[model samples]
Target: MGTSFQDKSALVIGRPSGIARAVVEAALAEGAEVVAAGRDAQKLRDGYGDAVRAETVDVTDDASIQALAARLGPVDHVVTTASARARGLLGDLDRESLLQSFNTKVIGPAMLAKHLSITESFTLFSGVAAFKPAVGYLGVAITNGAADFLTRSLSLEMAPVRVNAISPGVIDTGIWDALGEPGKAEYFEHFRTHNPARRIGTVEDIAQAVVFAMTNRFLTGVTLRVDGGEPLT
Candidate 1:
């Protein structure tokens, strides 16, 4: 977090809100030149203002990812926080939804790792749902599980260049806004008492974990469980 990021270039691809946006802000604060890319160009610009170079890339599309890689010649660090959630029980799960989830969280990043000229480290996103499955988390579980696997295998394949994954707990990213205030509050309240952390996670928690993964050259081929002991309880 100190001079590690200073004078370095980073490519952060994800949505402009929640964990992605927070990572961008954190990298900028660390004096890294950050290029923020996501599916939404306007939101990326709006979220980061003049602080970042906003661009567009859809993780589900290989061509889009390839094009983005071509545009970004080289970078010291690359972090992909993009993910898609298909919320349905196994019985109701559709093939396309499951495929899309894997494509975004796994395959897309796999392509990114293959094409991007990453000099320092590459960080991907995973979630506690992979280990702690819920009623409608079939898609989340498998996709996140695959992402963690990718982190390990890629670290070996891309040796000398660190590869890590960040597995976050239920964080207060605006993702819960879809459930409305009452539902979100009730959901958080339940986790507040259920998890050993006794509180929900924040975007900063995951962002700082990413910074650690990027700066610590020796830490590689592992998934950093920044879930605040959510899987323990």
Candidate 2:
């Protein structure tokens, strides 16, 4: 793909961190007018400076999403990295958490499609956990699986607008920072040994994949896996 977004405009919905922040930076580098939208306008502005138009948007709230869409008008691309983490065993999972997960991953994107007049494409975020199900992350897996199907359905329903999803593995997006340094090292080692790529993923890796999905016209109704061969093993 050509590395130029000269006249393009993009709206990235999620906090200014991890893959979302990298996507904004990548879009800016490619000359696109970008809006880094999230629940916190100040956080977005603080993270991106004047390079992007930071707007407040809570994907879970229909009114908030609609207002942002109205203010921005039409956009060339809409990338939603918004997701809620609901972790627990099947028995331990509560109804509220499960619904919240769906609201964030599945319903939120559906709402975005309903409100936003996306001209080029819409990209949603999923995860490898959906494919390689784990013991305690049943909620995450179910919601991510729904997200994949949502992308496929929207791609057909939305027609020429195009829609796709990206499923990433364990990337060093600071999400693992909560697991102290020692804990992180142990998990990273485990990931390295288990994954076919024998290494962890980076935010840049996933960001590049998002850029590919955004620019490629022929790709739709697909979930591009940006994982380091994690699912393969």
Candidate 3:
């Protein structure tokens, strides 16, 4: 008896991401059958190897999501890694961008909960932005808040189907690399100075929190903060 979820099945939305990739690996190592969904199935295959079942899913599209959900046979746990690149101030953000971000971060996970079996638990992603809104972070804050609230509400409504969120602070995901070296350094420095932990988070840190929530039957409707006490700053 290795673990109860040894042969359990999981669906991880947005498999190529830093957190998502770590989760897939963790789940598989724990004897889980993981379905890695994303826009690029090949990337998932390349990264996770041939053992993973890859699905090219566009979360923003209703039909695409519906079709995938229809085929996800008896999903025990669902974790969504889908997130949009944050953008805009309150005044500068447009409807389409806002909706795109919302649809991915909020609607996508909601739909997954709606369509999937989710017999055990469902985990969604949120961020510290939801709690500590910042300048030019209007969309991110809105979407993040929406996601956390959605999980809490869904947890109540979908009882017995544990639903929760993980709100991680600045993690060392390479997406930050897209911000360029100087930007990355500045961002990390801010987290280092401001966070109680004195360093940014890592993908594995967030993943461990996810595992705890999902495996603990007594927990639900909670937003576990895995930012190493980042908000305490």
Candidate 4:
């Protein structure tokens, strides 16, 4: 394959999740030195080993993100999978719930781009919710929509740092554990019928999309949807 991240280092956040892990792994596999960060230091270490430098980071906190950026040194790329799993309809969602979710996904990644001198490319996680709305997903849609706009706008101000977002649909990233058994089963059944792919997404699938955007050099201020054509149908 051709080089996408030639002679560069990458700083990846939220390495605990499958999608984040895959992005870090793909960056490494592409010959980039990775400095991976997550809330769980031991987990990052355990998951990535010595080949990937690990840092303890909570993306929701400014200090934690600053410390992470400082530790990672100058980087040629930045990517985040730092969102929390919280879902509710607007009527049922409280201020704290909304803020907490945005704090992780919206504010966190935006702060990273503002504070850190990310290289030519920066990638943040959006979701299909940004465009295709569903019931009980108002909070996610708002936060992700905000993130998409922020990513695009930041790309202009950040200049050479081409900022973009990835909108993945229903990736089977063990995040379903938060939904409990019944909710999880319900989600699977819903996707089995509604999604065009007839299955859930893999982390590697999202990872490859991220890697493509980061290294493509021409893509910026865009949200690449890796949803297996679910939104089309």
Candidate 5:
């Protein structure tokens, strides 16, 4: 609840780029000691260096999540921007893809709540597709929708240890790189023109919202939509 994270310790589980990396930096700037973990230990170590305690864990694996929890002891804040999405149209979807999506974004965080020593707050990552649906995003939709409810359910179970989710819009997180340069540009341009905010979101925009979710004690059980008001227009 306090502005100062001077004495706080945070565990951020995700890759060493974009939203996760931004959150780690933001916490450090606010004077919190951070442990950055992801599936690739080498990448994490290489990216964070001495500035943070870089580690490794596969959120989709229960043992991996538990092992990291035991090793880290207690932490004041827990965050996961980790995501595994299955993007395809209805007929193209497969069971394994759907399961991967759920495990990484929804079930993985659920297991994290069960295993991790969260002393303060647990921040999960959701997505705007849960609100504004479209073709080729059914897998993304169901997984993110579940995560939204998971935030509320965990808030009740975690109680005083605040539980919330950050539902981000189209941030420049390199997730769109799969679309190729021109395609990515076209996608962002569409949002720029149609969305109420009239601009693509930056990682900093998401980081600011995550800080609010962590600092505001009254914000539990909520899914903070940092989506440039896309669902509205």
Candidate 6:
């Protein structure tokens, strides 16, 4: 059976931008009462207006996540796109950066599962880095891989409440804004030639996939790859 969010409630944790923002918009369009949670309350309010209830949350802190859970009561779906970027070669990595990366990408969501009274499902954000490990993305690969494992484990433990991970490939989510216009264009062109889809993924692609994972009755303990077939290459 398929799921609809006509009257359901969803909590999205992460910055109110990029793929996270797209997910919030999509959820609202589907009639879900959405709550946008992140470290920036004002940013959330500014980005989403009154369409979503902006709540502050620091996923790295257990207390913060628990407190937010208490405030929201129960929710039908929980989607955490929260992450911290730690880029460096394995030998050059620092202990603090590595731990912080794991704390945000893996441990944070694990803690949410422990505390939140979720009624339906929990969808975590993994990435293509987990599969196609790059030179400077060692820390990201490790944390994302761990998150995928955590999702599977939680699916078994959480039972009736489904758990899954969405591993998105190189998407044009403006996360590459740091690359500047020229660099961003080059990046996409490189992927455009190589990826099987011959194009980059989009925020809408990921958002729709997330909704599917949340509503699909029998999909749990799985990592849905929204990558443009990059891993296969």
User: TM-score of predicted model 3?
Assistant: 0.94
Candidate 2 accuracy as lDDT: 0.92
Model 6 regions lying over 4 Å from their true place = 1-3
At residue 85, candidate 2 shows an lDDT of 86
- Considering summed lDDT, which 10 consecutive residues are worst modelled in model 4? 1-10
Task: Write the residue-wise lDDT of candidate 3 on 1-233 in tens digits.
Answer: 23747868888887576999888877877778889999888998888788789987888887887788788867888889898856777788888898889999999888877776778999999999888888999899989999999999999989988999999988898888988999999989988988889878999998888888778999999999887676666
TM-score of 6: 0.97
> Of the candidates numbered 1 and 3, which has the greater TM-score value?
1
Deviating ranges (above 4 Å) for candidate 4: 1-3, 178-186
Per-residue C-alpha lDDT of model 2 across residues 1-233, encoded as one tens digit per residue:
34567899999998888999999989988889999899899998988898899999988999998999899999999999998889988899899999999999999999999999999999999899999999998999989999999999999999898899999999997889899999999999999899999999999999899998998999999999988888888
* lDDT of prediction 4: 0.84
TM-score of 2: 0.97
Candidate 4 per-residue lDDT, tens place, 136-207, comes to 998888888888898888889888778889999988878788899999989878886888888888899999
RMSD of each: 1.2, 1.3, 1.6, 2.1, 1.7, 1.8
lDDT, candidate 5, 1-233, per-residue tens: 23458889999998999999999999999989899999998899899999899888998999998899889988999999888889999999999999999989999999999999999899998999999999999999999999999999999999999999999998997788989999999999999999999999999999999999999978899999999999998
lDDT of 6 by residue, 1-233 (tens): 22378889999998888899988988888889999999999999999899999999998998998899899999999999998878998789999999999999899999999999999999998889999998999999989999999999999999999999999999887679999999999999999899999998999999999989988999999999999999888
lDDT of 1: 0.90
Cα lDDT of model 1 by residue, 1-79, tens digit:
5566999999999888889888988898899999999888899888889999988899877788788888888889999
> Which lDDT values do the candidates have, in the order given?
0.90, 0.92, 0.86, 0.84, 0.92, 0.92
lDDT of 2 at 96: 94
**Candidate 3 Cα deviation (angstroms), residue 93:** 1.2
Q: Where is model 5 poorest over a 10-residue stretch in terms of lDDT?
A: 1-10
Model 3, runs deviating above 4 Å? 1-4
